[model samples]
Target: MTGGSGGIGGAVARRLAADGTAVVIHYSGGAARAEAVVESVTAAGGTAVALPGDIAEPTEMSELFDAAERRFGGIDVVVNTAGIMRLAPLAEMELDAFDRMHRVNVRGTFVVSQLAARRLPPGGALINFSTSVTRLQQPGYGGYAATKGAVEAMTLILARELRGRDVTVNTVAPGPTATPLFVEGKSEEQIAGIAAAAPLERLGTPEDIAEAVAFLAGPGGRWINGQVLFSNGGIA
Candidate 1:
């Protein structure tokens, strides 16, 4: 799982490990945080290893996959949850910020998906992260949503590209979630307003999103491919 150091990624890693999958936790930085997650997984008697790399770099990502295969014998599922979110209206958004976001979000996902396509064995699954904002049509999310829109498009086509290989490709688009990345900058009112947008009347938890990922990674979701599963609690 990429972004294994982040809240949602950490939850996905732990959940997969608990299900007896040997997890390769990928982090761009935060070696310490990643190590803590590994320790937690190991303490729970699950197998895990932390690997660091820039998801946008082919060489670095290849190294990560190499390490995972070396340690685990094979890779069954690849979940890319590592991404950056910078909100600004299109008019005010700096070109540099937009480029950085696309670098990590769009280009990064593409690179990882490409590697997964070549490396993953039959019966494997590749899960990419997106956001509900694409459907929500929320302002200030233009650039971020564009990247995710590209992800969704790529995901659909990749599934067909891998046809008959029995390797499923899909994207997971989550709604507003209660994570440091989501909660750090918003005021209580803003947060509450977003929470209320969902029928659940609350922000999604990291674990909530992880559950959707686990389903896609597991046998239960084998029939699902070339689709974007929205885990938004009716927000869109």
Candidate 2:
């Protein structure tokens, strides 16, 4: 899992571990946070390891995947939740911010997905992360949404490309969630308003998103290929 140190990513790492699947928690800069997630998983009798690498770099990511395969003997499911979000209207957004977001969110996902497409064997899966903002069409998210839109676009094509490989390529798009990623810059009022926008009347939890991912990666979702699953609690 890439971005395994972030709020939603960490939750996904633990959730997958709980299912008795050995997890390789991948992080970009949050070493301590990633280690904590691994520790938690091991404490619960699950196997997990924290690996650090730049997701946008293929060589580094290839090494990371190699290390993971060496440790676990093989990889069955690859979930990439690594992304960075910077909110600004397209008119006011700095070019640097836009470039950085795309570097991590778009290029990074592409790099990892390419690797998964080439390496994963039969019964393997490639799960990528997207955001519901693409459907919400909210302001200040044009660039960020564009990155995820690219992810969604690549998902279906990649699934088709892997036709006879028995591999599934899918994307999970989450709505407003209570993670640090969503709550960092927003005021309580803004958070509450967005949360209330969903009929569920609350922000989604990371675990809620994880459940959707777990399903897709597990046997239950074998037939669910070439699709984008929105785990957004009816917000969009």
Candidate 3:
């Protein structure tokens, strides 16, 4: 699990561990937090390990996968939840900020997915993270949405590329989740307004998104491939 140190990624890691799956928590930084997650899982009688690497670096990610396989024996599910979001209208966005977003969100995803394609055994699943912003088509989200759009496109093509391998690849696009990343800069009124747009009338919890990811990584989602599961609560 890449980005396993973040809010949604931590939730996903914990949930998977609760389901009796050993997890390798990958983080770009936040080593202490990642270790905390690993300790929590172990305290609950689940197996987990914290691994740190640069998601955008192929060599680093390759080492991560190697260490994970060495620790767990084999890898079956790879959930890439590591990403950065910098919201700015296309016209106003700085080139550096846009490049940074693509470096982590697009390039990072590609590097990990490529390694997974080569390493994951048959019957494995690869779940990439996207955002409902693509469907929302909101202003100031063009750059972020473009990165996710690239992820979606790569997911579909990779699924076909892995034909007959029984390895499933899919993307999960979430909307208005109440994670620190989403709630940090917004005011209460802004958050409430966004929440009200969803039919559920609330911002999504990290666990809600984690549930969708757990499904795709488990047997119940075996038949689901080359698709994007929108866990947006009908906002889109």
Candidate 4:
């Protein structure tokens, strides 16, 4: 799992671990937090390890994958929850910020997905992260949405490309999720308003997104391929 130290990624790790799957948690930073998650999983009698690498860098990511395979013998599922969000209208957004988001979100997903496609055996699944903002069409999300949109497009096509491989490639788009990354710059009023926009009347928890990811990476979602699943509670 990339971005394993982030809110949604961490939740997915724990959730998958709870299902008796050995997990490899990948983090670009926040080594301490990743270790904490690893400890948590082990404490609960689950198998897990923390690995660090830049998901956007193929060589680094390849080494990371090699390490994971060596440790676990093989990889079955790849969940790429690594992404960075910077909110700004297209006119006001800095090119640097846009580039960085693309590097981590779009390029990162591409690198991970490529490795997954080449390495994963039959029945393996690659789950990528996207945001419901692409559908919401909200202001200040142009760049972030663009990055996620690319992810959606790539995942959809990759699934078809792996037609006979028995591998599923899918994207999970979460809406107004209550992760620290989503709440960082928003005020309480802003959050409440966004939450209320959904009929569920609350922001989605990390676990909610994790459930969607777990389903896609698990046996139940084998028939689901080349699809973009909106896991939001009817927000879009």
TM-score, per-candidate, Cα-based: 0.98, 0.99, 0.99, 0.98
Q: Which 10 consecutive positions of candidate 4 have the poorest summed lDDT? A: 177-186
Q: Could you tell me the TM-score of candidate 2?
A: 0.99
What's the lDDT for all of these models? 0.93, 0.94, 0.95, 0.94
**Runs with alpha carbons beyond 4 Å of true place in candidate 3:** none
Per-residue lDDT tens digits for candidate 1, residues 105-223, read 99999999999999999999999999999998888999999999999999999999998899999999999989988889789999999899888899999999999999999999999
| Candidate 2 runs further than 4 Å off | none
> Which scores higher on lDDT, 1 or 4?
4
**Model 1: how far is 206 from its true place, Å?**
0.5
Which regions in candidate 4 have their CA more than 4 angstroms from the true location? none
Q: Cα-based RMSD of the predictions, in order?
A: 0.8, 0.7, 0.7, 0.7
Candidate 3, residue 170: lDDT: 98
lDDT of 3 by residue, 94-126 (tens): 999999999999999999999999988999999
- Least lDDT summed over 10 consecutive residues: which range in candidate 3? 177-186
lDDT of 2 by residue, 1-236 (tens): 99999899989999999999999999988999999999999999999999999999999999999999999999999999999988889999999999999999889989999999999999999999999999999988999999999999988899999989999999999998888777887898998898899999999999999999999999999999999999998999
Q: Output the number of the lDDT-best candidate.
A: 3
Clash-forming residue pairs, model 3? none
